[model samples]
Target: MATLLHQITIDAPASRIWEMLTSRLGLQAWWDGTVSIAGGDCWRLSSDDLESPVTLKVVEEEPDKSLEWLCVQGDPDWENTLVLWTLEKAKRGFTIRLEHRDWRLSEIDLAAENTRWGERLMKLRLQCHHNDDLPVNDDDLSVWT
Candidate 1:
């Protein structure tokens, strides 16, 4: 399995970043998906790219420090995969470390997911720092529209 990692320091408090990581509204803003708390320790993330809702189980949550999730249901391609987000104090404010791991797929698929997540993180950074909701490009407007 392969892992993709991304790290960025945002100009925001850990509390704010944590909220954006854990809350439905915050996730929807950055992910450009239909996000809902399915129940305790579970969330449903739906997007046009997926044929069905993906149920993610909260694997770990460390307040303002870190959060991890395991994909429990939905697309076969994403099944059994993991996503982790870690936050740390930084000079600018806080640093976000993101990982999408356990890829049992083709290189092309993995690359696509990597790019998609990078774009999402950029939006997340913009939102936390400037409260901006504009898309980064015309083709990506669907994400913020």
Candidate 2:
């Protein structure tokens, strides 16, 4: 039950960042290609290789500022674990602060996950600010040595 926070800054506007955070369709690209937010409240996450019947709830939301949610039903340990994404516009670019509460993880896994997050945030900025028209080369598969 430790809170793990990570910060990622990208050269994109708050609106664009919000879209990638909230929209189901947009999230699919980065979140292993399976993201669903249905009935205006629920969050359904699944992977093509490891699908499950779990759904989360949106607890609070503020456009271009913050988005928070927690798993209300399945996976007790993961349930009620909150994900708070806060965005702040900077003089140069934008800063995204992620505060993950009530989530437990091993130190090695934590470092790996956060590194992946940083990479994804960088891709988000590139897709949003640089060129949405051009396709991104997303074939860099995750392989641990």
Stretches off by above 4 angstroms in model 1 are: 131-145
Work out the TM-score per prediction: 0.87, 0.73
Q: Alpha carbon lDDT of residue 134, candidate 1? A: 30
Worst 10-residue lDDT window for candidate 2 reads 136-145
- Relative to the true structure, candidate 1 reaches a TM of 0.87
Please list the C-alpha lDDT of all candidates, in the order they appear.
Answer: 0.81, 0.65
**Clash tally, candidates in order:** 0, 0
Instruction: Write one digit per residue (lDDT tens) for candidate 2, span 13-126.
Output: 777777677666456556664665544577677643323444667778888898887877655445677878899998766798987687676777566656655666666666
Stretch of 10 with least lDDT, candidate 1: 136-145
lDDT by residue for model 1 over 1-145, one digit each (tens)?
A: 9998999999998877876777666677788778877766778898877778899988888788988899999988778889999998998899899998898978998888888889999999987885543344332221212
Please report the candidate that would top lDDT against the real structure. Answer: 1
